[model samples]
Target chain A: MDTDSPAGRARGPYAKSAERRRQIVDEAYRMFSTRGYQASSLREIAGAAGISLSNLQHHFASKEELLLAVLERRDETPAAETAAADTAENADENAAVPFDAAMVARAAANERIPGLIALYSVLSAEGVTDGHPGREFFLRRYDSLRAGYTAEFEEVRRQGRLRSGVDPAMAAASVVALWEGIQLQWLYAPDRIHAADALRAYLDLVIVSADDEGADA
Target chain B: MDTDSPAGRARGPYAKSAERRRQIVDEAYRMFSTRGYQASSLREIAGAAGISLSNLQHHFASKEELLLAVLERRDETPAAETAAADTAENADENAAVPFDAAMVARAAANERIPGLIALYSVLSAEGVTDGHPGREFFLRRYDSLRAGYTAEFEEVRRQGRLRSGVDPAMAAASVVALWEGIQLQWLYAPDRIHAADALRAYLDLVIVSADDEGADA
Candidate 1:
């Protein structure tokens, strides 16, 4: 995301362009979340971004083009961040998997970016149908994230961290399901459901330890 | 659902009316799932239903009213079935909570009605924002379902079926999350993830008994 060189940073126009793009993405995300992808218009997006229609079009030729920009910024990069976190977790030779705490922390972070989260939730359901523009992106997301989670479980299993008889594929899939379920509930009733705590509890049950045999169910 | 008495069953006009209503519901659900609640129009729904626009309107006063009818038929009645299933489970004194397997079966059955499931997934995400007409109904559905699940868990716990140390509310919330999450995944990639099996495994982990100590993770 920070593609600015020292020279690029110093140039006023480059910085301005980058700033304008960010504003458009942010405003567009909020609008897309509220009005949805099909119903929302470019003029509305332009107005929301405080830029003229021509100016907005100058940056991105069409609404679909703008949507790709918003989606790329919102989902693809954060997925990389999640992958990095998973890798880091795997790298720790002595680190106990604090899956519970990690889930809690992630939920807390989500609370700060309701717009992006809303965009994700709304579009997630929207994209599931046949031939929707966002379907491919969402499917790719599930493919990669599920792969990452499965890899985490396999490695953890090797380290004797994952409990016995747990299928990595199933665990990975369940994790995705828990995540989506908890997120949807949180969006619908944030005050009623704690996404992180709910995830943490599931993690605890899944990631059993040697001593957990004596632990309460 | 089967309200047909001998007289009702024999009457062609009544049967035709019922069939027409069902066709409208099916078409509306498919359209809503694909195009979304906000963007999809009454004309389009009527066209898809193979009925006159006015006739469709007669059956369903508006698109929102049609959506409510779909929600009621697809979700509400099935939810009642699930509750009855739960009550039956509670009645079995020797029954181990196969909450996960039951979850899977329910999901597989959902696959038989992709239109209804897709309608749910699509509309659920759409309804999270302010001023969405379906928001109140969805929120109430969650509140009630969560309460029902919690009550079931509490009763099961009293009977010593739920694992010790588990909170019923959290457990209920997790079940809801898993169901939502798994369904979305199945919609996205039916080939990759077996939503039911994924849910069953998570259930096994959470509802563990003393015997499960030696069982697989």
Candidate 2:
């Protein structure tokens, strides 16, 4: 019977606070793509969000905190993709997620959220130093990504869908590298480099068919 | 060819000046790997090189100039690599310089001057903006690198040393990506992740053979 009062109270200031935090995260993420962390000050970020320094501080408190939040959100993309892949390969969880070079390449070339790509390309590059705030986060990310891709390639190779001499581990690492490298170029010269076609071509090389030489001949 | 005339007069101060400039560049490049372009200050760089601020200024007026010098030096790596490949391939200019993944990988993994790799990884990331100083430099670099690698891959393909379905252009882009991505990781976790092994593994995947499947089957 008293649910209404409690619920209303919870919905009022708490809701606004959540919205403010979300807004700060959005502005910080936006800056990450363009101005980047080093170039943009926390004050500038607050100004971009049309919020007072105090308000922004109340939400993130520090630039590193805000960046971590952005990284958390950034994970949504690959997490979403992997989940979708898992769903598609539901009948057998262990089945290798077939490399869809052309589709992935085309999709990357014409992605909806280019900001994600920009944010990643810039931030990952900057995270290589000794004590970068995002160092641990990026290292873990590379490990997980390489491991995931490696496992997939290994499965595919085991099934003979990859060339015999093609080492699954190496292929996995290369694929990860291919993606990042493609994104790096795309961020700079979007018009010149076609990420999709480039990726698809690499996939064609690795993904074995029943008769690669025969078809070509 | 006077023994000690105008040429010797020019040599004294010029020699000292050249030595000073070289010292600054060396320190600047060393700092780039450890502290990065964004984090290291000009003053700190001068301090590291045991030179005064005024002396540093005499050589490189700004961070951009210093960075350009280091990058110029960095180009020597690939140039040396290609030259060695050329010598190995004889007078055949069109030889599909075999993608030496293992050698490249090992070289990258155990590089003596890791500063060059570190400097590149950091600067390339920072240059991802619209008009960052290094933007044009990096863009041109990617284009040149892609074109060069593409030609090499094309030669490799024509020689039937690449997988049948692999498009040379795509393979070239992938190779570029592979190097960059691997370098990115190597900068981050030099001990944990061996860049050379990973790259060699990838090379094993793409480089074709006479019996890719026939011998396997």
Candidate 3:
């Protein structure tokens, strides 16, 4: 069978089918992140991607499908840092650090990702249901995040950076909880709070070095 | 002109009408808690309460209305004590005790109001939206809870309960955040964790006496 059909032609030789798919997903992400999932229409996504609605449908069957794809794409992004712990060979190098200032800064910077934060806040609230599409996604997402933090804490312990007898899992869970809880507050009073700063302040408390504790106290 | 029209008679006595509304709300809460808001129909709640849907609607115009009423009712109940710094001369002496095994045992031994817990977990997750009726309610609820905790911490400080240099507002916020965070986990994996126990454990950490720090270490 000839590969140069109308569809094949639409996906140029330089731009493979996967590339086209990514382009569509990227546009969808931009739209959804800006206009919200409920307000951003598939037609607008198609228009933004310079493709027809039918072609968009050929790529993603529905808005839900596109949303799932956007989330999946985000999941695959290296920014999540799920494998950062396992890949780090010299975790002790940063063990003496008072806090992961770089990571906190990066997370803080993400506050400017337009509607991405609001989208996450909205979807998470909806994700509590058993059968919501985002349910398994968030569960796995949180689990992976928890595991990543736990691994970091383990490294901190190996280097004797953690406070004596600190339960890493509980501490990590508390950190995650603080992030989410603070997100809730930010959503309610966006004008009054800086979610990233609040999170950074909490992290500062937990990540205090042995030398810093006396100063912190 | 008649005070005892068929509709009036159907509502029963004044006291009975109030009781019936409470009963309907309680039943609706149970249904919504177990089945989730979208899945639990007004018909099912009515059936559970042994009343017709019309009767239920007469008391609450919609399922959302009923859920709100139930939530409002729950708000009137006493919450977990904030860590009070001071004990008033006539204040309950046991207020600062961390919720522990005894509390869980009491809760479990009681009428199995898993419905209320379930309702809270489900609604809290869903209530993150801007216009959701429960949104403002929860915002105020959390604010009140935080205020109460902060007050208790300040009181305890005055009474020499809390250690020096601890910021009571920050500590109170942490406690609230931890409680909310654990609740998310409990929702996803009820068999793996108990919200009450997790909260109690965290509270225990906060309330540890200065002399006991050595033992903890």
What DockQ does every candidate get? Answer: 0.66, 0.50, 0.24
Q: Compared with the true structure, what per-residue lDDT tens digits does model 2 show for residues B2-91?
A: 336556565867776777888888898788766567667789999999878887998899988988887776444454333211221222
lDDT (CA) for every model shown?
A: 0.71, 0.66, 0.59
- Give the per-residue Cα lDDT of candidate 2 at A136: 88
User: What C-alpha lDDT, on a 0 to 100 scale, does residue B81 get in candidate 1?
Assistant: 42
Write candidate 2's Cα lDDT for A1-217 as tens digits.
Answer: 3235656555766877877888888898898777566666789899999989988998888889988998887434454332211221232343344446423633464455566677777778777666668888878877776677677666666666775566666666666677777777777777777676766766666676745442211
lDDT of model 1 at residue A23?
89
Interface RMSD of each: 1.2, 2.0, 4.2
Q: Estimated TM-score per prediction?
A: 0.81, 0.79, 0.68
Give residue B210's error in model 3 in angstroms.
4.3
**Share of reference contacts found in each model:** 0.86, 0.68, 0.26
Per-residue lDDT of candidate 3, residues A97-167 (tens digit): 43355446545655555255555654554456545566786677667656767787776666656655456
The worst-scoring run of ten residues by lDDT in candidate 3 chain A lies at A82-91
- B1-217: candidate 3 lDDT, tens digit per residue: 3356665655557757788898998787676665556557889889999999899889889877887787767544443322111111213445555333334333333224444555665565456543456777767766765676677667656555564445567666666665566656555555654555544545444445646432222
For DockQ, the strongest prediction is 1
